[model samples]
Target: MTLGFTALVTAIVGEVAGTMSLRKATTGSKAWFVAVAGSYVFAFSMLSVSLAQGLPLGLAYGIWAAAGVALTAILSKVLFEEPLTPVMGAGIALIVGGVLLIQVGSAY
Candidate 1:
């Protein structure tokens, strides 16, 4: 895969990990803070790589935001037993649709 693609994937992973760690940290655990910091470090490095790889800033940012929001919502529901109402689900679907449109535009 291209560097930009790799960076994007890495960024997503880091973001997910970071968010999870933060939730864990809320339980008064110092170790989880380490996880939080590490995840952010990895995320920032990957974002820098994505930008340096010449991916359009708007495209890269849009994908990052969309992926982060969707992943966080899904994971929160799964990991924390957070209830997902119909309205929230529909909003997520719309965000996913918008992400698809952005990607299609980038491909051309």
Candidate 2:
């Protein structure tokens, strides 16, 4: 895989982790706040690295945001016992489809 793609994946992972940590922080675990801050910083840093490696901003950001949202939703369902309704699943699918369009369009 390309360096930019690798960095984008790392960014997505960091963003999802940071969001999960935010959920924990909201539940009164103050220690998770530190993780939230650190994860977000790392996520943005990796996003910048992806851009520096010649990844277009629109494509990179679209994929990163879409993947982060979808993964976070699924992980939250599994880890926190949160609801994952059909409507939410459809929304995630739409987001993924939109990101795919952006990726394909960028190829031309």
Candidate 3:
């Protein structure tokens, strides 16, 4: 994959990790707060590099938001026992579809 894509994926992972840490810190323990700060730093750094790599704003943002939303939804369901109704699933699908369309459109 492209470097931009790689960076975006890294940012997504970092953001998710940071969010998980925040949740843990809130409902589990105090030590996890450190993770929240560190992970967010990592997340923002990755996103900055991705933009510096000349990735189009639309492509970078679309992919980032889509992946973040999808992964967060899954994580919430798994970690917090949150609901994942069919409607939610469809919304996720739509996000993915919109991201794909943006990718295709921007390629041309």
TM-score of each: 0.87, 0.96, 0.89
Q: After superposition, how far is residue 34 of candidate 1 from its true place, in Å?
A: 1.1
User: Considering every candidate listed, which one attains the maximal lDDT?
Assistant: 2
Q: Rate the local accuracy (lDDT) of all candidates.
A: 0.87, 0.95, 0.90
Predictions: Cα RMSD each: 1.8, 0.9, 1.4
lDDT winner between 2 and 3, please give it. 2
Task: Give the alpha carbon lDDT tens digit for every residue of 1-108 in model 2.
Answer: 999999999999999999999999999779999999999999999999999999999999999999988999999999999999999999999999999998898889
Backbone clash numbers for all candidates listed: 0, 0, 0
Per-residue C-alpha lDDT of model 1 across residues 7-101, encoded as one tens digit per residue: 98899889889998899899768789999999989998898899999988778887888888888888999999887888998998898789778
Candidates sorted on TM-score, descending: 2, 3, 1
Over the stretch 40-104, how does candidate 3's per-residue lDDT look in tens digits?
99998999889999888788888888888888889999989989899999999999999999888
Q: Judged by lDDT against the true structure, how good is candidate 1?
A: 0.87
Higher-scoring candidate on lDDT, 1 or 3: 3
- TM-score (C-alpha) between model 2 and the true structure: 0.96
Ranking of candidates on lDDT, top first = 2, 3, 1
Model 1 clashes, total count: 0
